[model samples]
Target: MKNHRKGHLINKGNAPYVLLAPTILIFVLFMIYPIIRSLYLSFFELKSGCYQFVGLHNYIVLFHDRTFYKSLFNTVVYLVIQVPVMILLALAIAVLIEEKFLRGKAFFRTSVFLPSITALVAYALVFKVLLNGDHGLINYVIELFGAKGVNWFYGEWSARIAIIMAITWRWTGYNMIILLAGIQSIPDSLQEAARIDGATARQRFVYITVPMVKQIILFCTITSTIGTLQLFDEPFILTSGGPNNATITMGEYLYDNGFRYLKFGYASAIGYVMTIIIFLLSALQFKATAKGDTD
Candidate 1:
């Protein structure tokens, strides 16, 4: 029995690691390997389907590429236009739905969030049909209001505006659900105390609710920023990066290089550049929010 006990003790030290081995292996295989491989590939270019070391040549080409700049511009527009509108709309919807006396809120909330659960491709197709230039349902409705229907995918600015609207439609409910969770996590007692102090509704919200939930708000903002910057599905499915490259985003441009044009090296470089951009933006946002908190 003493020998058996000693054997068990010997096995115990490595048992936890043995159980954790599969998870660690999977992470290394999928996450770590891809990152390392992509970085390595970024420094080489394919010629006649064979990779040749090119050093920083691919990155230099990326910086000078007109399409790359166009994609970066579209991505920034998505981040600036869609993100704030969605966040503000979500906050408003969350506040309205969180009202305890509101009736049938469960059904209403579920309906609003339904679009988010709809597959990206599926909803993108739906929007494409609805936004069709000549006989779309949306255009048909606008005709009833005595306004001429405009081709949504026709021009650069108009197409981008349509993209913004599509993004807002799809994501507002998702952010609303997040903000609602944040609202419910706040204590009721502080709200009640504010009411007793004769605080106006707007004042109470600005001072009490916003401050308390700023962390969650910050999280939603960072996530939305990342999502907007990496946006692909909608542009790919709805516009195919568009009639004149107007709606092309970084992801689509990357896809165009890696697969369509078979420029794997340049695509890898773009992917790394986008990764750096995302990291910098996220860090900047975090630092700014931290400063606000300190004040």
Candidate 2:
């Protein structure tokens, strides 16, 4: 009887593991296996079903690749400019929408958020038409002032501006919604007490509101940074990386290498490099934000 009871307890303890077996197997097969396979492929020369071991060759080639460097530079520029602008704009919108005295709050919120819900392809097509140099709506407006329409996608700087505009239009509202949720999570009594203490609106925002939302802001910053690092669609669709590879991003380069050029190994290496850079950048951002919070 004692042995039978012990055996029963052992079986009971193993039951949960048995239940989780399918999920664990699926995760390993889908996620873990792909990552490991890609990493291995990155160290080789892929040809047909066979690979030749060429350790570090892909990475070495990446260093000499001018297009890769250009893509890296463009990606950095996008992150530096787009991330701050989007986050700041989102914060402003969230604060305004969350104000108790604000009327038509639903209308404002919905209107602002509508762009985020719009299909990416639809928005890209609209932007392409709007930014067209000859007869685009934006240039048509500029032509009213007797100015020649700018070649938005033809020039390097103009191409970058167009890409930034597209990114901001699509993502700012999503960030705002995240921030609004954070703002709503803050207790109303704190703001009421601050008001009762004769705190100015600006003072309340800087002191009470900002501090409470720092974590959410940090979360947004990290996520936005990762997204910017992997940004592909806007540049690919909007400018095709421009007339001179001006707006090529890491993600674009990866796609070009893996699919267009059929250099899967090189693409895998680029992907891994991008993964590392994104991880490092995100870690640094989180640390800096945490330190600012303490200060």
Candidate 3:
């Protein structure tokens, strides 16, 4: 009986693989399989509940679609404007929060980070109401100041601006918290050394602090780039990509095709194209930052 029990027990040599089997299975099923399936499906069109193979047709059509170009352009606009402004704002706030002379550091840090935790749908709805042309709190305040209240969503630029503002408001604090952690990790001894060597506050920050936190900043930038490129909820809720599709983003466009219009193949093509763009852009950023470091 003892010999049988020993034989039935698994060998320790194989124990790690046995323990990892479930996780590996789940990952293959949920992540790897979906990615492979999506790539395969991108080459086929859905008709009458059946998939018809149409290799490269979806990709060809995607390039010619004016709406695709519009969404891509709009996403580029957001990427160009929102990312830099949010990163800079976060850096400034993080530096201020780390200042030794600052009062109520805990309270201020919490206040800054609060918006990042708010539900995306809820925040988008709130921004929509606040930016409403007729009865919004923003318009009301503008009226109080003796200026005609602007119809924020009626114009193309205005609608884009409203979305950008909402994105920044929600994310800036989150980035600030990350940047603050990076800032805090720097040795106080370095700053003290710089100060003792007749470095001004600005010089110390520019030279010592910024250099130490460069990698953290790079990490934040790459994540922010990915997030901005994949942005959807804010514009979807706030403007419904309104006023002539002025605020429609690539992600929203993909959602529209996949869920709204039921063009699964074309949507899958868009998804892969976006995947390529994101990869290229991230690679460029990595190359640029690395070159800067060398120089």
Best lDDT among the predictions, by candidate number? 3
Which stretches of model 3 miss by more than 4 angstroms? 1-11
Worst 10 residues of 2 by lDDT: 44-53
Per-residue lDDT, model 1, residue 106, is 95
lDDT by residue (1-295, candidate 3, tens digit) is 9887676674666789989999999999999998998999899999999999999999999999999999999999999999999999999999999999999999999999999999999998999999999899999999999999989999999999999999999999999999999999999999899888999989988998889999989998999999999989988998888889999999999999999999999999999999999999999999999999999
In model 3, state the lDDT of residue 50.
100
lDDT of 2 by residue, 1-295 (tens): 9999999999999999999999999999999999999999899986777888999999999999999999999999999999999999999999999998999999999999999999988899899999998889999999999988899999998999999999999999999999999999999999999999999989988998889999999999899999999999889998888779999999999999999998889999999999999999989988898788688
TM-score, prediction 2: 0.91
Where in model 1 is the C-alpha error above 4 Å? Answer: 1-10
RMSD of 1: 1.7
Listed per model in order, the count of residue pairs whose N, CA or C atoms clash below 3 Å is 0, 0, 0
lDDT of 1 by residue, 179-212 (tens): 9999999899999999999998898889988998
lDDT of each: 0.92, 0.93, 0.94
| lDDT (C-alpha) at residue 265 in model 3 | 92
